[model samples]
Target chain A: MIRSIFIKETQLLLKDKGTYFWLFVLPILFIVMFSSIFGNAGTTTYTIRYFDADGTKESRQFMDTLAQIKGFELAADNEKSLADQIQAVRDGKQTSLLVIPQGYSQRLLGKGAAEVELHRDAAEDAAAAPVAAVLDSVTKQYQEHKLRVALKGTGQSQTGIDALLTAPIQVKDIKENVAKANPVTQIVPGYTVMFVFFIMITMIHNFLRDRDSGMVSRLKGTPLKAHQYLIGMWLPNMMVVLVQSTVLLTFGFIVYGLHLGDLFAVAAVIISLSICATGIGLMLSVLVNSVNTGVAIVQIIAMGGAIVGGLWFPYELLPKAVQWIGLFTPQYWAQRGMQDVMIRGAHLDGVWMTILILLAFGLAGLAVATASFNRFAAKAKN
Target chain B: MKHVLEVADVVKRYGSKTALDQVDVHVKEGSCFGLLGPNGAGKSTLMKLMTGILQADSGMIRAFGMDTRHQMSEIRQRVGYVPQEITLYEKLSAVQNLKFFGEMYGVNGAELKQRIAHVLEQVGLSDRANEAVETYSGGMKRRINLAAALLHQPQLIILDEPTVGIDPQSRNHIFEMIRGLKKEGLTLVYSTHYMEEVEALCDDIAIIDHGSVIAQGSLHEILEQHADQAVYVESDYITEPPQLSSIKRASARGRGWVLESEQPLHTLRDLSQLFAEAGARVHALELVKPSLDRVFLKLTGTALRD
Candidate 1:
C-alpha cells in the first residue's frame, strides 16, 4: 500500500508543474540570492604579506609569526613591495598584510635607540599602530638582554635590569582546537543548516499551490491512506533538499578544506534533516488550504526560523534570552549539530542531544499533521 | 456470494437534519441497480454509505458478503467509485490517471499497462490517452472518469451521474458502456436524476424521495402501480398550462399536453362529453399508460424535471 502511494505521489508530483518551479528551481535561485547577500560574512579572507625594509631581527620574527593567526589565507605575490601590497588590500584584491624592513641592528648595540618602520595597509584599523608598539616592546627586550651581556663583561649587577626588561611572572598562551583549520570550516555547517531551513520552509509555498489545483481532493480518493500518503510526498521534496545539501557541502569540502567528520555520520544527519523538513511541508500542506495561505505561512515561518536559528546572524552575538529562544527552533538544533560535527570535528556522541531533540520535533509535527489531516478529510467529505 | 451489497435499515443524520431514515436496500450479484433521485434527496449520502465513504449511523451495510465498517479497505480495493464531481488530477493525462489508480490497487508492470490500455480503449479515449485532462471536453472527461474506476476490474462499480452534462454522443457512448458492463455481469449502483436513464439502463431501481426510498421495484411494476393515471383530452388547448378538473394535472411536452388524473376512466368519459358540447374538434384521444416519470410525479407530488 505504501509502495503504491509512493508511485502515485511521484506521478502526481511529476504532473504538477508547480513542484518543479517551487521546489527544485526556486531553491537554486535562492542559493544564488543568499550567497551574494551574505557573502561577506560566509567567506574567508586571503592573506597578503609585505617585505618591509627595517631589516631588524625583531621585525623578521614578527613577519615569520603571522601564519599563526586564524582565517589567514596565506598566499605569495611577486609584487614584492609594501606599497603594492597595501594597494592590493585597498583595492579589495587582498586582505591586510604585515611589512618588515631591512634595518641596522648596530644602532641597538651602539646607542640607546633603535627605529623600525612598520607600514600597514591604509584600509586596516588605526589600531595597527599599537600592534606595532607591541612589536617594539619585543625589540626593546632584545636590546636589554644585550645590554646585560655587556654589563656582565664589566661585572655590574644585571638581575634588577633583567626584571625590568622581562616580567618576573610570565603570561602563558594556550592553543586549543579553535585555530587549527580554515575559517570557512567554521561557517560551513551553519550555512548548511540555515540554507536547509530556509529552503524547506520557503518551499512550502508549493503546498498552498496544491489547494487551488484540486490535487488534494483527487489524491484523497486514491487508496492511499493519509499518513502513508504524506510520506509519499516526502520523497520528491527530499530529492531536492538532499541535492541542495550535497552541492553546498561538496563545495565546502573542495574550496574551504572543510571536514565533514564521518562520511556516514554527515550523510545520516543530512538525510534525517531532509525527512524532518518533508514532514514539515506535509504538515504545512494541511493547515494552509489555499495557495495564498500556504505562501503566507511558509514565508512567515521561513523568515522566523532563519531569525531565531541565527542563520542570517550569529547567535553568539545575541543576548542570552534570544539565544535561549533560538534553541527551541529545529533549525537551531540542526545547525548546532552540524557545527559540532563538521566545524568542531566532534563525533556522533557529541550531537546526540541535538539528534534526539530533532527527532522529538519530527514526532510532534507528525502528530499535529495526523490530527490536521483528520480534520481536513472530514471537512472535504460531502 | 449471496449478494454484492445488502443494507438493512440504514439511518444517517447530519446534525439536526435526517439524511437517510430507515433506508433498506440490497443489490444482488450481476445486477445493474440504479438509485434514482433528485438534488437534496440523500441519494449521494446513501451511495457514500454503501460504498464505505461514510458510515450509517444506525444500520449495517454489507458489500460482497463482508461488512462495510469492518472491511472498508478490502471493499475499497474491489469497489470503484466515480464521484459526481470529476475527482482527478487535471494536470495528468488520461493514461497517467488510469495508471495511478491501477497501481494503487496493486496492479503494476505489464498487467498495469494492459489494463490502462484496455480501459482507455473501452471508454473510446484511446486516441486521447496522452492528452491532459484539462484539455478534454466535458463529455471526454466523464468518459475518462469512468475509465479510472474500471482500472482495478471492480466487482461492484458505483457511478454518480457518470454523464451528468455531456453531448448526445457521449451520452450514447455511456449508455452503450453500461449495457456492455451489464452483459459482462458487473453489478453497478448507478445514480441519476434523469428518470429516462433509469428506464433505459437500470435492471432494477429504488426511487428515492426526501430521505427515504419511497418506491423500489422493476420498471413495469412502478408503471403498473400508477397505470390508471392518464387523462384523455382533445381540444384546441391553450399553449399555457390548462387549469381544469377534467385534466387534473396537465403539462405541455413534445407537441402535446399530458394531463394525469386519479380517475382516468371517469375523467376521460367526462372530457369527451365536455369537449363535444363545447364544439371542439377531437384530434386524437388515446388512453396512455403511465411512465416512470408519471409514477415519480404520482408518488412524490412533483414532475421529474422539476
Candidate 2:
C-alpha cells in the first residue's frame, strides 16, 4: 500500500508544474544570481576620483604610483573643480576625492613636506577606507625613498640603508581551507538548504486538497489504514526533497565548480536534511486548517528560518544574537553539517552531532503528526 | 430473500443539530434499494453511516452479518462507496487514478491490472483512459468517478447522488452499468431525489424527510399506501370545480382540476355523465395515476425541491 501511494503521489507531483518551479527552478536561479554577483568580489575595483592642481612630472608620477595598485584606480575628473569635487563628496554623490596642491613638486625639490589632501564622505566610510589605506602606503614608500637618499649622504653603505628600510614587524598572511571557499560554497549549499523546506508547501497543498475534495472520506471506506496513508504520503515528499537537493548541488558543482569534500558525509547530510524537512512538512500538513494558512506558515518557516540560519550568507557574519538563535533551527544544523563536510573537510565522525540533531527534529515532527492525524482525518468531507 | 444490510434505529447528530433520527433500512441481496429524499433530507448522512465513514451516535448497523463498530475493516473490504462529490486527482490520468484506488481496496498485481482494464471498459472510457481527468468533460469525469468504486467488485455498492448534474447520455450510461451489476447478482444502494430513477431502477425504496424515514417498501407499496386517489377534469362549461357528493376536495392542476376522492372510479363516472348531460366540451377527464410526487406532497406538504 505504501509503495502504491508513493508511486501515485510521485506521478502526480511530476505532472504538477508549480512544484517543479518552486522546488528546483527558483533555488537554482538564486544560486546563479548570487554566485555571479559575489564570485569576483576579491578582484572588484574601486575608483578614487582626483584633481592634480600641479601639472608637473612629480604630480603625475604620484598619480601613476597610486594607479598601479591592483584594486584601486585613479580617475582625473577635471570637469569639476577641487571645491566642487569636495562638495560632491559632501552631497553623497561620490565616495572620495584626492587633490595635489600647486606647490607639491616644488616642496619635494626643496626638501620640504609635500602633502596631498583626501576629502571623503563620512557616511561612505567603508568605501573610502580602502582608498585611504592605499594612499598611506604610498606615502610610506616615498618616506623610505627619502630615507635611502639621506642614509647614502651620511656615508652609509647601500646594504645598511636597505636593511634599515625594512619594517620592524612583518605580517605574513596564511590561508587555510581556501581551495573552494568562494561565493560558490556559500550560495550552492545555502540555496539548496533554503529551498528544501519549500517541499512543505507542496505537502500542505496535497493534504488539504485530499481533505476538501472528499478523497479522504472516500478512502476511509477502503481497506487502507490511517498510518499507511500518512506514511505513504510522507515518503514521496521526502524523495522529492532528496531529488531537489541533488539537482541544485549538482548544478553548483557543474556550473561553478563547487568543490564537494567527502562525498559520503555530504550525502549523509543531504539524507538527514531531507528527513528533517519532510517530517516538519507532515506535521504542518495535519495541523493547518486551510491551504492559505498552510502556505503562510510554510513561508514563515522557510523564509524566516533562512534568514536566521545563515542560508543567505555565512553564519559568521550574522549578529551574535541571531547566531545564537540560529542553533535552534533544523536548517542551521543541516547547513552547518553540509558545510562542515564540504568546506571544512570533516568526516562522518566530525558531523555526527549535526546528523543526530536533525534526525531528532524529524522524529519529533513525525510523532506530533501521528498523534494529531486522527483529528485531521475526522474533519474531512464525508 | 436474504438481507445483506440492516440498519436499526440509526441516529446521527452534528453538534446540536440532528442529521439522522431513528432511521431504519434493510437491503435484500441482488436488489436495488433507493434512498429517496430532497437535499438536506439526511440521505447522505445515512449513506455515510452505512459505509462506516461515520459512526452513528446510537444505532446498530450490520453489513454482511458483521457488526459495523467492531468489524468495520471487514465490512469495508466487501462494501463499495461512491460519494456524491467527484473525488479524483484531476492531475492524474484515468488509468493512474484507477490503479491507485484499486490498490487501496487491496486488489493488487495482475488482477488489479485486469480489473482496471475491465472497469475502464465498463465505464465506456477505455479509449480515453490515458487522458488526464482534468481534460475530460463533466460527464466523462462522473463516469470515471463511478468506475473507481467498481474495481474491487464489492457485493454491495452504496452511491450517494451519483447522477447529480450529469448529461442525459452519461446518466443513461450509468443506469445501464447499474442494471448490469444487478444482473450479476450484486446488491446496490442508490440514493437520489429523482422519482423516475427509483421507478425505473429500484425494486425497494425508503422515502426520507427531515432525518426520518417517512415511508419505506417496494416501489409499488409506497405509492399505493400514501399516494392519494383523484380524478382530473377539464371542461369549458364547468369553469368552477364541480360540486359532487363523492368528491372530498378539489384543486387546480394545470388546465384541469384534480378532485380528490375515496373512490376515484365513481368520481370519474359522475364527471362523465355530467359532461354528457350538459353537452360541455370536456378536454381531459380521467382517473389520475398514483405517483411518488403526490405521495411526497401528501406526506411532507412540500415539493421535493422545496
**Using DockQ as the measure, which candidate wins?**
2
Fnat per candidate: 0.34, 0.91
Q: State model 2's lDDT.
A: 0.92
Instruction: Residues B1-306, candidate 1: write the lDDT tens digits.
Output: 357999889899999999999998878788888888878888888888876667789989998888988887788888888777776667778887788778766778898899899888888989989988999999988888888888888889888888888999888888898899889998999999998899889877888888899888777776776544775444575355445575667766556567777776776677677667778776756677567777777788887667
Classify candidate 1 by CAPRI docking class.
acceptable
C-alpha DockQ for predicted model 2: 0.85
State the displacement of the C-alpha of residue B302, model 1, in Å, after optimal TM-score superposition.
3.8
Runs in model 2 deviating more than 4 A are A155-168
Compute the lDDT of residue A64 as modeled in candidate 1: 57
Considering summed lDDT, which 10 consecutive residues are worst modelled in model 2 chain A?
A174-183
Q: For residues B139-168, could you state the per-residue lDDT of candidate 2 as single tens digits?
A: 889999999999898999999988999999
lDDT of candidate 1?
A: 0.70
